[model samples]
Target: MTSIEIRHNLFDNPEVSGTEYKTVELIIKKLQIYHPDILTSDIKDGHGVIAIFKGKKQGKNIAFRTDIDALPSGHRCGHDGHTAILLQFAEYIVSGNRPETGSIILIFQPEEETGNGAKKILQSKVLQNLHVDYIFGLHNLPGYHLGNILFKYGTFAAASTGFIAKLEGKQAHAAYPENGINPAKAVADFILALDSFKNDDISNFKQITVIHVNIGEIAFGTAAGDANVMLTLRSFTNKGMSELINNVTSELQQLANKYSLKVSYDFQDKFNALENDDVCVDIVKAAAKELNMTTESLPEPMRWSEDFADYCLKWHGGFFGIGSGENCKPLHNPEYNFPDELIDIGAKMFLKIAEQAMVD
Candidate 1:
């Protein structure tokens, strides 16, 4: 099947994070045509599929990774295109267009949107047994020119996590104003404290966004006894993020103590900062230049978090962006769709990178 066909199939059947069984099955089916040495044990869990293509001679193992799971909002982040690109590249390798030496490993990672997929895969024995030397991945950028390659050295993306604060207190009847301890004031004050945590300094790049809040049911007779505040905390560096989390935790603990309420907090969907290795960045640049694709250097790291950062933390890897189009909707937008034109460009880029990595 063509790249467009595969993309349409993936886009048509979208699965949210941690539940990509059908998606994985479809990818396995498409990959079967190539007849590569496929691994499905890790894929059985929430991990993902790993396809290995052995070369005629022994050499290093170069791996290219792509996310398989779609967002809750659907394929608005263009993961469908990302998966299609990798699949098309697999076809290229199977059709006698592979390296002369080393093997190639294609990783179709799942649950990237939830930020636990890479961590799970890394902990598994799959990648450890392969002994992968170099890793590479890319994302489609919607605001840049179509097919333009964008790269950034060092920190490429921010480290972020969801902070959920739960506050509990005794409920009181509405008629008896001061009968029970109310957590409403504490919740409001905590949110304001979070807002105060934001910094305008570009170097620090700290932000706290309130995503959700709940204070009880719709009953009018009883005062709210419990409250929840869901927030997203982000920073450019892991150190900075760690400091911020520490500060937030301490402050929340203090607030709970002051209000005499039981408060607990947990983090979810944590994404580490993406730091690109210089060698890997050079390889991507060389591939782009060889393909005559326009390249752009980003001035600053993106504020958003990506699960690929987990891989970069463990491996010598680089993550770049391919322009989707200047007019395309931003990622996660409800109306957003992955562009079909990117399939060939992305596939060619991956193939070139793999070939370059295979070179001595």
Candidate 2:
């Protein structure tokens, strides 16, 4: 099938993270045509697909990874096109494109939106057993000319996590005169404390966004006994992320103590910063150059978290972006569309990168 056909098939049957059952089936059917040396879909995560293409000679094991799940609303992030691009690359390899030394591992990773797929795969020891030397993945970026290659030396994307603070205290009647403890002060202070981190003189970039807060019911008949504060914490580097978490935790703990409130903390959807290896970046750049594609080096790391960072932490990995188009809608937007034109461009880029990685 053509890349567009595969993309549309995926787009039509969009599946959310942790539930790419049908999506995985379609990917398997398309990849079966290529007959990878090893095609296994039922792995640790149950949704990740691993395909290994053996080389005529043993040398370097290069893995090309792609996310296969879409957002809950739909394929707002264009993962359908990502799957199609890697599938097309799989087809090219079977069409007499063999590696010079080591095998090529193609990963159709699931739950990328939830930041769990890569970690689960790693725990499965799939890539660990393969001893992959270099890994690569690409994401589509809007607001640039179509087919433009975007690259950065390090921290292509930031690390981010969702934090929830649940505060519990005694409730009393509204008419009570300081008869019971209230968590309102703690919640307010927590927000202000986190906000202060924005001015930290730390070397790493950091940010905190207060997404939500809940104190009491609308009845207004009773004093508030509980509160919840939801925030998104972000940092440009993994070290920075660690520091951010530490700072937030310490401050929140202090507030809970001062207010005599029983506070519980939970961090969700944690994504480590995407660190691009210089060597892998140059190889990708050379591959782009060979394809004669226009390339741009980003001035700063994107302020978004990417799960691909999990793979890079274990192996020499590089992550880059392909321009969807100058007028393409931002990702995750309800009305955003994955440009069909990107299918061919992404497929070509993936194929070139794979073919070149095989020999180099």
Per-model TM against the reference: 0.92, 0.95
Candidate 2 clashes between residue pairs 3 or more apart in a chain or in different chains: 58-101, 59-101, 59-102
Best by TM-score: 2
Tens digits of per-residue lDDT for model 2, 136-248:
99999998889899988988998999999889998888989298789998887888777767633434789999999999666577998889899999988899889888998
- True-structure lDDT of candidate 2: 0.86
Which candidate achieves the best lDDT against the true structure? 1
For candidate 2, the 10 contiguous residues with the lowest summed lDDT are: 195-204
- lDDT (Cα, 0-100) at 198 in candidate 1: 81
| Cα lDDT computed for each candidate against the true fold | 0.87, 0.86
Clashes of each: 0, 3
